[model samples]
Each structure stands twice: as C-alpha cells, then as structure tokens.
Target: MAQHAVPSAAAPDARPATPVRVPVREILPWAIFAFVLAGVLLYFVGAEQGATSVFGGTWIHEFTHDGRHLLGFPCH
Candidate 1:
C-alpha cells in the first residue's frame, strides 16, 4: 500500500495581511490629554493638601482623603 500526501486546507492565493498605520498626529493630542489628566489625578491623590494644595480650604483634601491613604500618602 502506497502512502498519499495530505493537502493543506489553506488557499495558495490568500493575500498577506498589511500592517496598520497608526495616526500619531491624531493620537498625540489625546495621549497628551490622558497624560495630563493622570498627572492631575496623581497630584490630587498624593499631594492635594498642605503646602502643595491647589484649591483653598479642605474640600479637595477631604474629598480625596480615602484615596490619599489608599495610595500610601501621609495624611494627618
């Protein structure tokens, strides 16, 4: 008995996938916005009180109190 070769299921004429182009210019603004937003959030969580406070009174500090302690920031 002769052994027969198995044929591949994939088509030979299948086109190769093209690499997708990332629009840097379009994404840059949003990336920058996200970075700034993250920085602001970090500031609020880490240093939104004492001398580094941006807003007057204890409103911002109290609002983010739990977040501050959760993030390991010293609060007294």
Candidate 2:
C-alpha cells in the first residue's frame, strides 16, 4: 500500500512584520487636553454632587437641597 502526502497548514505572511511607531510629541498635546477636560468635568460633577472642603461648605449642595425658587421654571 502507498502512503498519501500530508499538507502543511501554515499561512503566508503579507505584512512587514515590524511594529508601528507612536509619536510622543503629537500624543502629548492630546493627552494634556484630555486630562484638563476630564479635570474640569470632574470638578463640575463634584460640585453638583455637594463636595466640600474643610475651608467651607458646598454652596451648590445646600442650594440644591434648600429648594429652588423660579419665576418661570418649577422648583425641583
């Protein structure tokens, strides 16, 4: 009896096989921008959430709880 030949299962490479380069200089500006934006957004969220320091109490927190008086809008 004759034996049949087996086929290989490896695939051919179509890429350069080198890793892509990242530019730190270009990335630095966007990183800083994102950090600053996140900080500002966090501040607003904290303020809305009634965050206070030792120096003083949260005015917005108090105002939100004290009840809002409005001429055209309903108090919530």
Candidate 3:
C-alpha cells in the first residue's frame, strides 16, 4: 500500500499578503478625461436637439433618440 503525504499548516516559504496600492496621481488624468467624456455623452443624449445643438441637424437627435427616452430626458 502507498501512503499519501499531507501538507503542513505552518509552511516556511509563505509570504504575507499585502493590499494593492492605487496611484491616484497616475489615475487623476484619466479620471478627469472620463468625466469630460461622460459630460459630452450626457449632453448628446439629453440636450442635443432644437436650439442648443452643436451640430445643426436632426441626425444627432435621431441617433441618440432611444437613449434620451431610456434616460428619462423627455425629448418629444
């Protein structure tokens, strides 16, 4: 009969786990970029129609038509 070896509770080579450090300085630029992008998207989806449109056409409104209704902007 062959005997199986069991692992010991106190392993010698195991190192302590450390929490991941997030570099805010590195992330700040991208965060600001994303914020600006979100603002532009919100403008297109909610208010890109009638008089306050950047592009002078109904195409932008039609493109984001369903999105307006979905986000409860009342663009009818």
> Top model by TM-score, which number?
3
**Over the stretch 1-76, how does candidate 1's per-residue lDDT look in tens digits?**
6743753447575567799998999899999999999998999888888998878999888999999888889889
Error of 3 at 46 (Å): 0.4
Which of candidates 1 and 3 is the stronger one according to TM-score? Answer: 3
For model 2 the TM-score comes to 0.43
lDDT of 2 by residue, 1-76 (tens): 6743643344354344688798999899999999999876454434445233322556654554433332222323
Query: Which candidate gets the maximum lDDT versus the true structure?
Result: 3
Superior candidate under TM-score, 1 versus 2: 1
> Who is ahead in TM-score, 2 or 3?
3
Cα deviation at 52, candidate 3, in Å, is 0.9
Candidate achieving higher lDDT, 2 or 3: 3
| lDDT (C-alpha, whole model) for all candidates | 0.86, 0.53, 0.88
Model 1 global lDDT (CA atoms, 0 to 1): 0.86
User: What TM-score goes with each of the models?
Assistant: 0.73, 0.43, 0.82
* Lowest summed lDDT window (length 10), candidate 3: 1-10
Q: Each candidate: how many clashes? A: 0, 0, 0
lDDT of 3 by residue, 1-76 (tens): 6643753457675567799999999999999999999999999999998878889879999999999998899897
